[model samples]
Target chain A: MFDDKFLPQFEQIAGYIHDGGAVAIQQILHAGRYGGIDLGYCVQPSVVPQTLPHFRQPREVSKEQIKAMITQHAEAAKRAIKAGFDGTEITSFMGYLLANFNSKFTNRRTDEYGGSVENRGRFMRELIYAIKEAQGDDHPLIVRLNGAELMDAHGGNTEDECFELMKMAGDAGVDMISVTVGWQEAPESSIGRDIPPGHWNRLAVRAKQLLPNIPIAFGVRLPNPVMANQNIADGEFDYWEVCRPLLAEPELLHKAAEDRLDEAKHCLGCMNCLSRLFRDLPYLCTNNPTLGHEVEPEYHITPAVVKKKVMIIGAGPSGIECAIAATKRGHDVTIYEKSNSIGGSLVGYAAYDMANKEDLRSQISYYKTMLDKLGIKVNLNTDVNPKLMRSILHQYDVAVVAAGAGVDTRGLPIPEQEGVLVTAADVAGGKVKVGQKVVVLGGGKIGLTLAEGLSQTGREVTVVEKEKRIAGDVIPTWKWRHTSWVEQLKIKTLTLSKPIKIGASGVTIVNEKGEETFLQADTVIAASPRRPNQELFQEFEFMVDELHGIGDALVPRGLLQAIHEGYRLGVRI
Target chain B: MVSTADEMFLDTEGWQAILDRRQEIFTDMLPGASLGILPKKNFDSPVGTMLTWVRQADRMEVAYQSFTGFENTSVDLLMVVDDETLEYLHSQAQDNAFNEMKEQIRNGNVLLYVMKTLDELLDLGYEELIEVLKIPVLGACR
Candidate 1:
């Protein structure tokens, strides 16, 4: 229905885009039961109640209405050919119009287009036949199908049924099968950080087995290019479909071809892109902030018109980002880190957790490789004091203070407390010793990570927090993962319990309900809040002509915020 | 236990040993089965922390269900360790919409367990826990 007005816009887009030798294909879909929810009405095979509250219930489609919709899809395909597209991909996945018609859960009608496998796939078959007829047999015609709806509980198609439907589409003369996973109504997380690399390639392999002649394209949470290549090599699928990974790193293929895999920015599988799409906003990447603004000239890092000497203090993510961006802009850059490693906090945090360590290490290795390639000067174990700041100001045109934050160790006041208190930073840095029975104060992200890390070592770990919840600052999509990990490790956490005193053998905790208890601990670690380290910035602000404070030195925040701040400063300077 | 000024901390080598131990434990537990841990609340309790570690290890198939909310039912097994979680499940069983769960429980297809405390749960060990829970119980479901 909306294709009538979008024809010219499609033509304009086709004319402007020129990716060398890459065939442009237009994808068309009818929201079907999922369509026009904002308008409060949609036409489907049957009236299926909306699972999510935000969506509106669709009106049942009569036979005549079905015939009209089929004609409309063919017309849309014709329009796409007119718009200079080489082919059109009809989407019958993710509870779209055709998918809803194909689903037994939604298609309860007893007419020619319902019930049995052949009947359930009748609408898709008709649509595909019409599209093939509209454009010649040689014209590229792809059909996107859910290899498995993953919605059996919702009365959706099983893997075998999906295979049958794909065969039906193949019989209907669809040139290619783009295999995807799950539906909108599927209860599980089909594609997220929780799903391992190359986990869903079996679905594609199954589709390939059924549709042997047709080329199969598959992608769902497959971010590792090496793993994707292996899957392709093993004949899982003919083509590796990628979208979000490109958003994370546009030069992914180019990097893979050049054997620069380490330099390639990999997708973290954080689901920020998916989240933005669900929110009806443009897709954005957490690792790469310049993703949605590819067309903007300012977002692209070009050679600086007037290059200057840039000195960055602290080799954390923020400082490293600034150094890289500045160096890319043809500026002389030097980074001074008090620690030996390039990744300040990440080195510690990543080293503590086994599951996410490799991904985090990959990110750090990429930055270190880039720094080496750019020939950026890096001085390790160099503390920047008042005298060092004075000397740095004299040498560089601009000085960026990214000294990072310090852990808060000023624990609770008690009369007879004599137990040792160590900061979370010390624990993460692998500096402080923790006994078999340990108690961590503060149930935030740092506290939880430390507690989990210690508990995994077969230590009796307990986390005490004044707040009611742990990892409260974690992203919504990743919160379940943290919660699940804590539960599995059996790390005891007492919430709404304040640390009263730290004694030689235990800590006295008082709950909000005025209940007092003593938790025995051989070691006590303070995972409290962090304060900004800005003393050097304050001292150097008046000494340097161009002085900037970024990252934790300016304000203690997460990695995304720090990188964004560093990037903003890099391009501006 | 030691004095505040005289306490000792593990150095980088000591921390690495801990990491190695964790990795060894995780690797030794495969090929793992899916285990669901349902908690009464959405807080940083022992259950939550354990679930987080299991997920992070990537060796085991684990699911966490918060008693306050129900999101998905894809897990192969369900663990209820607290009264609040069991009560929530009972309430869901009363609802007609949760007929699948009720049927699974009735037919001994769902692995249901109600433990007393975190220590009792951990003492069973990962292998023993899976062996005990994965076995289809007859009368425990009711």
Candidate 2:
């Protein structure tokens, strides 16, 4: 609810973002039973208690209270118009006030605003009509409603009932309909990467069939623009409602339009943004570092005052990102890759899963396309050492060392068992032959991912970790998916286990409480404790005037840090 | 580094051709609308001098300025320098630039046109620009 007290803040935002051409829209909502418990009381259509412990129970609202609620919605819409917004959208999803009234799960009132589909939808209908009357019918109003509550067993509305509610809202003079799925209490992952792109299009298609005249904005785990366009072209939905994808890559539409779909940083479907929002923190993209700092001038890419010839060693994510950013700043960049191809760890990791492989491969393809387009010279199979660097000393003004990491077997105290033990990198890289019963030495992300991949190939995989948990290094948002995959694949994970000796036949492990066990394995793959390869960078530190170290060359970290470091260095240099 | 047409470092004629192509596209697409062409500042290159020549060229209400940064001002259309310039435009556009321009276009205020090179503009004809403009301006404002 907006009032004159909030006008100053709204005006300040409007003025601050007044880049001379903006159509700011205000969204109004009432939490009802979902309102803060600290407020002392909450009102709902009926006396419904929240399943979650943190949420408070709400008292039933009387008929007079319902009239007051409708009046409040109308007043909020009028305030939004006065606050300089082009229009206002009434939020009736995600277990909000209006959504609670419309949902059969929360609404048990025998009054006109409850019971049948029409009665359950009456509150929303009245709210929309009241808002339109308070402002004007031509005020570009929109109604945001859930296509499916995803709470089928919890007395939520069905797809048919939701479509009927949409028709009701459309008939009430809403300019457009925004379709979303799931609620706060839904027992499903609706917007995660696990859900394939355009998975919720059937909901939108049904809405279009029901309300053919009203425009539909479809969203809920749809990230691909190609698929979005195809759906629109096929008339499944009028608008592809994108939010998280835009957060991941701000220039998604622009890059798609320029035929640089690969160049566009696709949303990895890592729910880091959603995770942050759930914790009441500002959302950030795992891949794009400039996401939340849009207003900062430092994040804004500006043309370099002076262009220099830059030499980046290694063709990993960090190296490629540095090359791209530096080249974009008009610098002449040449990447010297020790391997024959690009995407150092990414190339190996892409082979771990079918869906993930496609996503990572697209990114690698984008890097290749961008490198080609920017005229960046990539020297493959050309490892840069001191002697080789001295030969090309005059060629580059600045040198960036991103030589990446090396596998260290120190974590596993097993004796050197030649020809029996292999690194997880080797197994993931498909360089080494894996046996039928393979024991992965570590339970980090690499180990778990490799285990999942190995299990897919019908190999009996066992991950032994000295630590208590597996995939500890994985991003929190994606940890569940990895754990679920490991579970589904039936990959055995032995925690609190230490390798004592590595024989030709199997490895001897000492578990907690002084228990010793022989985990028979045909082959052991070491996946943990990677040390940084800072030799080249350290050797050339004094030789060049401008020398920098980034990515795994500085320290063995994940892709988020590597890419961010590359981008930071690229912009700074 | 590998050499390409864009990396060749545009001379006076090359820059003039880019300016001419932009003027033609903007003039044709927005017909009788004021245009502002902002080229990235290259102190060591001849583009700065070439922009001076372009500013003096006989074009209808075309405002030319060399800026190292971005700013929003009064203009019917905005013409940028190169891919780097467009990349900057894309970065800013992420911060509600396109949405704002879409609103402006709907209200007959402004239009944003990005050209990587003179040839790219020529390759993307007026019809294509209209089609591209229609999406952000009319279709996908949200």
Writing each residue's lDDT as its tens digit, candidate 1 over A120-234 gives 8998988888888887676789999988887675568888898889888888888999999877655456777657777788889888888789999998778888888988899
Candidate 2: tens digits of C-alpha lDDT, residues A229-296: 99999999998878777887878887888976777887777677766655446777767988878888
DockQ of 2: 0.01
Q: How many residue pairs clash per model? A: 25, 1
| The candidate that achieves the highest DockQ relative to the unseen native structure | 1
Name the lDDT value of residue A274 in candidate 1.
64
Q: Where is model 1 more than 4 Å wrong at Cα?
A: A16-18, A32-37, A40-44, A411-419, B1-88, B91-142
Q: What TM-score describes the B chain of model 1?
A: 0.27
Identify the leading candidate in terms of lDDT.
2
DockQ of each: 0.02, 0.01
Model 1: number of clashes? 25
Off by over 4 Å in 2: A5-25, A31-69, A108-116, A414-417, B1-142
Best by TM-score: 1
Q: Per-prediction TM-score, please?
A: 0.77, 0.74
